[model samples]
Target: MKSRKFYISVFILFLSVFSVFGQTRKQLEEQRKKLNYEIKQVNSLLFKEKKKVNNALEDLNDLNRKISIRAKLIATINSEARILSKEIRVNETELKELRKKLADLKEDYADMIFKSYKSKSQQSRMMFLLSSQNFHQAYKRLEYMKQYTDFRKKQGEEIVHHSNEVQAVNDSLLVQKALKDKLIVSEKDQKKEIEVDKKHQEKLLATIKKKESSYKRELQSKVKAEKRVTAQIDRKIREEIERANRIAREKLKNAPTKPKSVKKNEFILSPEAKALATKFELNKGKLPWPVSEGIVVRKFGKQPHPSFPGITVNGTGLHIVTKQGQDAQAIFNGSVLNVLVSADGRKNVLIQHGNYISSYNNLEKTYVKKGDTVVTGQKIGQIFTDKVSKKTKLIFVLFKNTTRLNPSSWILRR
Candidate 1:
């Protein structure tokens, strides 16, 4: 009984290890799928053949993004390969042990069968029982014979079970080895693609360097525009917060209850608004994308300019590039705080989820107006496609009242 319990414990431990391995393998597969999809989106949206004009900066940036994702995909494949290698090794060891165990069981069973054959005659077994000195001795001899027969039968069954286990482990080892080989091949292909993209990136960089002055001027103008848009967004959000607070204060003055102290820059929330805010917070890292399908071309925070050394580009939000004519969607349930129009006629729609806000920018038309309630995945407006660059990009930003948050950290990875 103790031996059986020991075997069961070992089997459970083995299963748990494989369970963790399977989960990790599944996660890596998901990451690979997402990376592949993003790469396809980048190629289809940014590298269209109809984009006749040569924009060196944009081209370089797009190539860089592609190379980066390919590298990540390769890394993911490598990780999966490592896992497969480990599994294969473990399976091989188990197969060896199982085969040895099966061999031992067969040998022992053969020995038992040989002894049983030697005492095959029923008359010989009866004579041995009759040779006992007393009735009790004869009874003991009979019971011993019965137990020997049962033991032999059990030995045969164990041999069969061990043989089957050996076969199963051998088959598992073959599958793991094949998967490892496939991953190795995939990693090689990704490396080759990265090499080609790097060459193209070099050419784009050289072209930019040749016309350095013009490139610098273009970069400065773009940077100035980014700052202007950021300022507009900040002002609008601040104004919204102030407006909400003012309304809350007005209601308090007319009511019998004492007014609660409020912060100057933050929102004062009612019970319902507070609940909505809590829900939004709980759903962090699970929010949907502003567009159904898009690639983040520019991320939030500060990074050195890809074209020029020393100069840095500060981004206040994520710039996601998608197919032309794609409509922007609300990531969560919210009310439209305001529709902001920039000097270039591009519109930005801001939606408020209690104190949390999501902003979608670079739209040519607006579908929902201020004070309109929007549900998750609701289409708010159409994304503006640049005629010159031929890029359709949406700038998405998130905030907690007056605090800026990284959109990447909040949105779903895919």
Candidate 2:
């Protein structure tokens, strides 16, 4: 029983080790695949068009994104290689143990066979049994002989099993070693590519620095435009919140049982809306992207301006760079609260999911209008591609009532 327990424990340990390595390796491979896809998208979308206009800032942004993704890919490859190394080591250890166990079992079986051969004669076996003191003793001797034979057969079977295990472990080691080598080679190639991109990026930066005054003026204008759009959106959201709260309060005032005072600045949701909000909250970090395929060029919050050094730009939302003509889709089931036009004539659509509102800005045209219900992944508008810059970007924003939320944290990571 103790031997059986020990073998069971060893088997469990073997399974657990392989299981962990397999899961980690699978995840790394998936991450690497995603990064590779993003790289291809960046090249296809950003580099396909010949530069009709010379915009060093735009080029630098695209190159920076490519470099960032390449770096991630290298890191994932490194992790995969590490996992493979660990797996190979573990397999080697298991193989060694299996080999030793097989040898021990073979030796034990051989000794048993030798002893059995010494009593090969049936007549000698009968005589030995007859020499027992009584019938019960003879029966006991016969039972012992039968159990010994069964045990010897089992030992032979165990030897065969252990031998197979050793072979399997050896094969696994070979596969893992090959994979690790491949991953290492991939990592090196990615590093080289990133280095090349970095050099190109530096050249672009230097060129932009030569025209620092002009670029800084362009950045200032860009910042002002972003701020104007942010203010318009904020005003619209506040108006909607106030209007919704007023209606909710009126309804409660007419009711026989007066509830606690509702917050004037927040949305007073109905029961259905409350349920929807709960579901939306539960799905945080799992919301679909505003666009089907895109890379986030600008994240939420303040960061140094990409074009000009020593200048900070406050980004209220995510700027997702995508292919031209890509449709902006609703991230969840919601009603279109409003559709506002930016100063540049580009359109923006706002969808309300309970108390949470998501806005898609920089659209060429909007398909949904106010009060229109839209489901998850529903096409709401076409993303705008700047003719001069040749960049297609969607500015996506998320909010809980009037409070801003980072869209990246809420949306699923690509």
Question: Highest lDDT, which number?
Answer: 1
lDDT per residue (tens digit) for residues 201-269 in model 1 = 767767876888888888889889888778878987898899888888887787877666777778888
**lDDT per residue as tens, model 2, 1-414:** 122332353345434434333457888888778888988888887888776797887787777667766766776777688877877888888888888888899998999898888877545777889899999999999999889889988998898888888888888888888888888888889888877886787788778768878877887898898787788889988998888787877888888876565565578888888888898999999999988787777889999764455789887899888888899999999899889987679998989888999999999998989989999999999999988778899999999988899998999987
Q: Which stretches of candidate 1 lie over 4 Å from their true place?
A: 1-30, 121-124
Q: Local error of candidate 1 at 108, Å?
A: 2.1
TM-score of each: 0.86, 0.82
| Model 1: how far residue 171 lies from native, Å | 0.4
Best by TM-score: 1
Q: Scored by CA lDDT, what does every candidate get?
A: 0.83, 0.82
Please give the lDDT score at residue 391 for candidate 2. Answer: 82
